[model samples]
Target: YEVNQNSGNENENGNGNRNDEATIHKSGNRRTLHTTRGCTNKEFLNCQPLNLKGTEGAVGLAHWFEKMEFVIHFSNCVVECQVMYATYTLLGDELTWWNSHVRTVGHEIAYEMTWKSLMKMMTEASCSRSKIKKLEIELWNLTVKARPKMLQKAMELANSLMDQKVRAYVARQADNKRRMDNNPKDNYVHPGRDNILTVTLSRKEQRKLLRVEPWT
Candidate 1:
């Protein structure tokens, strides 16, 4: 009976040791598993989450980050290259970078990021338009102090949004030209009138003209 008890005790200890080993192995695997190659400093800054509102917002941002990580990991070569280009645009100087690199990967992503950043900066200003203007002036002053050339490009982007009238006018002109180009030929009339005009009408026009009755 004592021998049987000892065997049972040894069996229990063996099982416990196996379980511990398994646990350690599982933890090691988790630690070693990385979703993607590490992000660069600029990429990290570009992909950083905004200040979220609540737990729900935080979760949403976490999910977005995970999705971005997955893309970085498993996306095709083209998509990965695009993600890199988008990262550069968000954190780097657009004009200088644009001049340096001809390929714009994920252009839509860069556009959306640029717009969102500008909107956030605009919203942080005081409520009044005058206050917002003053804030922009102060921002420009600080930017110029740091690096004048960089600030010039930044100001150009800001001013592009500020000059809405020019954009509106250019859009209207383009729209008008497009409409004229697309106008249907079937809707228009021939220039000269059949009866009232001094020039003689063609046979087809004369026949149609004859069919019309004068007012009694």
Candidate 2:
């Protein structure tokens, strides 16, 4: 009877040991998962994007938007979180406008808004027609200033091409002269045997030759 009881006690102890090992494994996995979450949270905070104020003109707004998008992409934020993080960085007039917008739209709809829609609303509210016109005029002036350089480069390319064509024409003429020098009998096919044509025909004579005169 004592031997039987001892064997049963050993079986219970073995089962408890296995349960403890499984519990420890589950806890370790949970800790690792939590640590990973904490690390990502730190990363998101470290990579926070630039802020915006409503008073910043078109150029400043454009710069902020570019930086913001870069940070958002690096941070790997989802659509809903993107709006929250972007609006969190707003200051001064921009914050005031955001609050007004939220009050008008209500909390549920405002919080659910996409990042793109928020940007569009902000642009419409912030960038006035005068600022847009100013930006356009500046861009046009830059284009105008760049025109002379572009034209000069184009002219240089065209001149280089013309020079190449001229060089090719001169080389062909030289080759013809060399061939004539090598084969002197080729010139005997001229109008008369006594008339030794010294050089190529002029453009005027060539044109005249092309024109068929009526028989007198």
Candidate 3:
């Protein structure tokens, strides 16, 4: 009996290999290129590769992966290389700082893997809107965890955002107050029992108070 070479599982050229690599010629040399670029550098830094060994190392790797996944998902975009590098570099230094201080506090050396810690790492970099939204979502999710430490960290972040918003609001309110103060009234009235009280200050006086251009 003759063997049929054109089996359905075989390639057109009759190669029985299931995994086929693509070949490209560059500089007159044949080279094989993988289908995907694999994990990004940020991903590698954040997560351990599949080949990583040992349970302890694996745990640390998993921690990094979780923290980074939170950050990336919160930010809603692949962090730019420069920002990622800077943030991770800061995190490395912060880890060193925490380790150095841990001994003095009588606490064992613990990894500084917190959202606030990560935010501190990225302080020098401005996060995008998507990232901020993502962070908020992550914080909301963590609220259900109900751990005191996580809740405290979330509160701290919330307070920081609130403080910034309050400052902006106050500044806008002051601007509006100043605008109103500088506005000139065409008519004036005096206060009585059930009457209105309107004090017409001179343009110069108003300008002195509001620090705005006086109406001529």
Which numbered prediction scores highest in TM-score against the true structure?
2
Ranking by TM-score: 2, 3, 1
Q: What are the runs in model 1 whose C-alpha is more than 4 Å off? A: 1-56, 78-81, 84-216
Candidate 2 lDDT for residue 47: 89
Candidate 2 lDDT score at position 160: 100
Error of 2 at 4 (Å): 42
After superposition, candidate 2 runs with Cα above 4 Å error: 1-42, 128-216
Q: What are the clashing pairs of model 2?
A: none
User: Which tens-of-lDDT digit does each residue in 5-106 have in candidate 1?
Assistant: 223442235345321111111353242211123445355445543322222233443454454454444432233253443334232232344333334544
In candidate 3, residue 172 scores what lDDT? 100
lDDT for 8 (candidate 3)? 37
- Predicted structure 1: lDDT: 0.45
Cα misplacement distance, residue 89 of candidate 3 (Å): 61
